[model samples]
Target: MATLPVLGGKVFLTDSGGAKHLVKAGCDIFMSTGVTHRLTEILGFAAGFALGFEGKDATHPGQRIKVSEMGTALLGQAVAKPVGSGKGTGLSVIIRKRKNWDDIAWRFTRQDGS
Candidate 1:
């Protein structure tokens, strides 16, 4: 089983192959692998569902799955791949600031110099 930590808004990546990577805080929202995993914290932990790779072509160094804050799901079929190889895999959820109307307006104005 794989495991990650959810502490202080920071993300920790741990694959089944004993590989560990600490993702910087405020970078990725959260992630899960294709195995029964855990999201540990200082006080306790939560279990995560396995994103099974039963019918996948690439196993280890699995496909990179990036989920945006807008609920948009992006698969790394033609883009970035994972770190290692195996039947185990994980997901990366991006934490992004939501754009507001004012932000959009400012961007538009800046682009048009109006």
Candidate 2:
């Protein structure tokens, strides 16, 4: 678990093997696998759901799922896109385990099929 500041205010990534990373921020902390780290702006009631998601390797147990500062603001507003056009307002970060993704994926696949 580590902390690194996110500057661009956005994260876009594709699926890949499991690697560990930490979001270094004073206000918030979260962890996720290298490949699965996804960020989309939180919107609607889904915003609440998004906030509830736990990021892997988070320093605080309660904050398993976390979002950026802009995320919280946009969520409260319940806007689809950011107030000003340009890019989106908030981001949604995908979280995954570093130890073993195949194991988790296979396990869930069985349950889903059942």
Best by TM-score: 2
lDDT of 1 by residue, 1-114 (tens): 333466545455644356445455667533443221332331131111122112222322355544322333357555454443243544434423343422332111223476
List TM-score per model, in order.
0.15, 0.19
Q: Candidate 2: TM-score?
A: 0.19
Assess candidate 1 and give its TM-score to the true structure. Answer: 0.15
Stretches of model 1 off by over 4 angstroms after superposition? 1-78, 83-88, 94-106, 110-114
Hey, what RMSD does candidate 1 come out at? 19.8
Where model 2 places Cα greater than 4 Å from the true spot, the runs are 1-88, 92-94, 105-114
Q: After superposition, how far is residue 69 of candidate 1 from its true place, in Å?
A: 22
lDDT on C-alpha atoms for all candidate structures: 0.37, 0.41
